[model samples]
Target: MNTTISKIHPKEIKKVTLGAGAISINEIIAVSRYDAEVLFSQDYRERVNLSRSVIEKFLDEERVIYGVTTGFGSNVTETISTEDAEVLQKNIIRSHAVSVGEPLEKEVVRAIQFMILVNLGNGFSGVKLATLELLRSLLNHQIIPFAPGEGSVAYLAIEAHMALVLMGEGKAWYNGELIPGNEALEKAGLQPVSLGCKEGLSLINGSTSVTAFASLALYNSIQAAKTADIAGAMSLEALKGTIKAFDPRIHSVKRHEEQAITARNIVKMLERSEIVEKYKDYRVQDALSLRCIPQAHGAVKKVLKDAEFTICNEMNSTSDNPIIIPEDQGDALMVGNFDGTFVGIYADTMAIAMANLAKVSERRLDRLVNYHVSELPNFLVAKPGLNNGYMIPQYTAAGLLNEIRVLVHPATVDNTPTSANQEDVVSFAYFAAKKAYQISKKLEYILGLELMAAVQALDFHQPLKPSPVSQKVYELIRSVVPTVEEDRYFYPDIQFITNLIHEGEILNTVELIIGKLDW
Candidate 1:
């Protein structure tokens, strides 16, 4: 009874200030998904101005800097005069903007633009202050660049598309219409600036695009991981399974932090359940799906934690090439900081972990509806044979599970060289993060089906009630969907529960009953 949790409504947030490395995923979601205005502090603007001064001085002195004086990739040996520095920046934006596929989601485009803006605000990219402001204008005015969803090995293609929009070239989304970037700028009452010094290289040279997607993906996965636990607890009560396996003593011996956390959450959720107390069924021990909820979901939690660390660090740290050392003053250190190995590896790990979570959820859904295993009414329907009940949902879950399983193949393993072998051994972290995003959606649907079936089974428990947490979750579902006395178009019922899971309504209701679920 001593918990204090503060929640921010995304829609109500009006502004997000950026500087250095302090932005969290919530802030990103507010600006990207909720149209929150982006602002930079005076100190942030000064830092950018100072960094731009360094590059301008270098340009004045004709000091040779990688990606500034020389051509990009294999042509770095070809140097450019100060007169051509601006043109060099422009050409890179045009040349690298080769992403091909359907345009990225509007929120994703905003997130990408925001990430770019934040990185430049960090003052290590050697971009002009005006260029950074232009990026901010695109974000604030809601003119999203039409960045494609494909062709990125390490955020290059997508970011290039974003940079093109800044140059008044690429297509943009403005006023609910996809228009040319120049037109979008005109309507937004903004003008594009010509790239100068290292602006072009700086814009497309970093891993912001992949990091942006990874950051958002990590946020969503963490949400799904917590919701998965709630679904497991609800399934446990509905199936009349004991909480013996979640005993602290059993988990204390292993000392796996995530597993212990998950066990504690389950224990708290099923604290005073009548269903669990009267659960001496056919078998003394339940299947692994019921018995190892903590262990399985705990593994997923660990992966998500690792991903959060990697992504947040990437968000704060500058992932640019030839990073402008503000402290060192005019020294552009050329290094391979742009390598996305950490993001790629952790994203793959998260994908595999999520696939495992979904696999167990599918089996648990099997236990809820298939009467041979659940001992509940067949399909949890009043007339199983007449209506077909909740039979096809499990099949849908199975199909989604199969897709998730196939996506677990690590994208970092196969590296095809790009930029003419100058960029050999690329980390396809974008695809890995993208795959995790896809898996999270699929897993949500699978868990949604499980939640729907579990709530239906709880209806049969009747006089015997679920725990406080599960009861609240059941009521939240019933608020959106009536009890499935007979299967009326079950897809809508499944979708309603899925929306609850995705929108955090069910998780919020359950957490209110029993403090916050384990991370």
Candidate 2:
């Protein structure tokens, strides 16, 4: 139930994530600073040094710098005296902390904290060691800033995140209370930094906020897909849908790789099942969501894998620009490393595939809950008409599906060239990642509804049990959400399941009872 990832080697991120829920900041600390030396190249060192020179120039002459010596975004070129850069940074943080939606959940906020720390620990941002320590301390203490929800443009997630780091103006949590960053810093015995040369630009230039969305999205999407596969098979049993459609021979000919993989997994999950049958009125086929689980879910799998590769690379790589070149290195030319395009496209890919997966889930949930076709009780209620049963939960699920449809629009498609068009053509990955997360969070509740619904129907199967593996799943849900003999207030139960599912306790239960499955 705790579902903690014990040891995380950076390369084994996927497996670790499947087990632990999210990558913790502790993971960055696992790789010592020595690894940082090997990860950066001579060119990396040269760029960092060159970047340092630019910042040094701004400092030595008190000349106005675009972001550091002035303000940020749409006002980057305004000249500010060097004395004001620190105040500028603080002001930027305070004024830009204008996010609109509900505050991000703590786990989500923690994910953001980890990402920022990882980026800084790579030592590419020219961030002082002390700043990194502040981030680490905040993470370890469970104090998180309340990052607002607006300001996610396609090309970048600026205008908001910058306001906090530079100006120390935004809200942060110290110990547990939300307060201004400076107050939090003071409470935590930390010192804010000077917005030296490229520091402000470095702090707010990238998309860690968006990347946080991507990680949480990708993480939840992974669990949702798994939940879909398991629940799809369970629904197959509850509906008495023919297993022949998932037969190996049917998928073998198409060379549909995922089809084969899915078939194998379903077979594994359904092994020794008391419910599924080889012959049922010799029924020929299953519904598309059920029958096509391999294709739909597998597409998500492949896309998630690609997105993971990009995201992991981005997390480990340096994205700050005007990079410092070490004094010892001379062969490299200064260039831009702040581009988030790879993830921008990948985030779009994640949104598309994640929404599609949710679409598939909606279809299956419909089949499972709508008693007219389910041949089970209406909404899986034992005494229909008197008890509404799962009817309202379906409403909740449908709400999420509709929301995902709205968010499925690609975030990367719209981009405004910035930096006076000097840095034209942006990835807008931040929006892509954030929306991916938003859409995916809504999806958890939807999947929870369907999962609970399917198990409820399975409960009505008289004396039959699902596979041993799935019996555990059914019992797990059944334990929390008792079979609805007559519908009562079931929303709380469904909500509880959704939260537990999001916390990944159910997933860990699966891993504990059965063996871990592949993507």
Candidate 3:
């Protein structure tokens, strides 16, 4: 009752978290459409025209502006006719759509659209209300634009989004078929939004994609880290780990906040476990993976907390250049792009933390599979030389682990100058963070495979009984993997078992019987 819970509000368009799953983008589209209702409200559009009057006064008086009348980027002082302004903006979006890469996951595409609508509705850019309405109709009617993922690199999902807006060349999955942007627009009974002078600049030149991707990655990372803790506890019991290693006195000296906290959690998870407490006579210390769970998992927790603060702020704030600035001297607003120092640093920091999580996870998988420590028949085999056992699973895990290392290289570290050196250093932070998330999923499946193998090995001891908690895990795996006797292509079984882990079947099943087990 005393605790505070975080919640999302569509009314506060600035800080909204994209909803979960494929239709999340659509959900945010609902909110963005609502905001559109506000922006183009009979009262509000009048306010925009009123806002336009200020710009008009400045224009008639010949003020030196940025994108209002002048050309963008280095071509600042080169002014264009107000009549040609809309054409200039349209050209910018079209020219910048030169993104190359795979199409974004549908949810990401939706987030980009929602963020675009939200930014436009903020009443900064001189976009007509129809611009936002066209996007709303596109979302409402499921007319997805076929945007490339090539440009969602640095700023929040801007590159591909700009591409989709400009040439109107993007694909969207409609009903069950993917279609072209023009067709999608037509099918939705809408025309492509005609951009105003600063409208396209306002749309493409921001960080919504990066923010959305970063936020999703961070959310999943928290769950993965927690899953790691549970996995560590499970592995510890299966291996007969020593409680002494997790003793509060040992952690008290280090006093690292999350480390100590997680060490305590591991202790609590192990309490009353008959295997760990009773099996102490069997082993003096568990392997490094089991003993050092706190350090590895705790590090991820700290990183996640920091990334949360940074990304949440980024999602709520603006990253567009030539940002509107209210000036008293002139009726027009002074606008310019600000530096993205914090987003760059924090996003990269998040990437590194996630990489380390996978690094440690790969090690744990090795402990379970490498024939030496696993104490099984060279690979959790039931027969001596007749079978290969879980050899391929280990190979798959190792291969995936190596891929994580390659992706772990920080995206922020290499800053190539772009926009004629106007954007000298860059973030591409979401690039690293997004890849880190994909790698995390692979590792989860990898670890789940290893857990299956470990459980298979444990079952060879027909007479020995595991602690109540681990017994549930073993039962969960048994329900899927069964006891692999002679050997039949085990990949399908591995997949079946890993899916249980990925989908929380094992964990959820464990929770149901856990209280009864007295573990």
Index of the highest-lDDT prediction: 1
lDDT for each residue of candidate 3 in 121-239, tens digit (9 for 90 to 100): 54445555655666656655655566666554465334544346334566666676887766666666667765655566666666666665655565556556656666777667666
Output the better candidate (2/3) by TM-score.
Answer: 2
The most accurate candidate by TM-score is 1
Query: Local error of candidate 2 at 437, Å?
Result: 0.4
Off by over 4 Å in 3: 1-64, 118-129, 151-169, 325-341, 461-479, 490-519
lDDT of 2 by residue, 345-376 (tens): 78888888878887877777888878777888
Q: Which residue segments of model 1 deviate by more than 4 Å?
A: 1-13, 280-282
Across 1-519, the per-residue lDDT of candidate 1 in tens digits comes to 211112564556688988733777778778887889999899899989999888888888888899888998889889998888889889988988988989889887888888888877888877888888889988888888888898788867788888888888989889889999999999999998988878888888677877777766776677788888989988988888877888899999986899999999988988788888888453578899999998999988887877777787777778888888867546888898888778888888888988898999999999999999798989889887887788999999999999998999999898898778988878888888788878878988998999998888899998987888888888888987887666578778888889887777888898778767766
Q: Is candidate 1 or candidate 3 better by lDDT?
A: 1
TM-score of 2: 0.82
lDDT of each: 0.84, 0.65, 0.60
Q: Which ten residues in a row have the lowest lDDT in candidate 3?
A: 1-10
Query: Positional deviation of 242 in candidate 3, in angstroms?
Result: 1.7
Evaluate model 1: give its TM-score. 0.96
* Model 2 misplaced stretches (Cα beyond 4 Å): 1-102, 154-168, 278-281, 327-334, 417-424
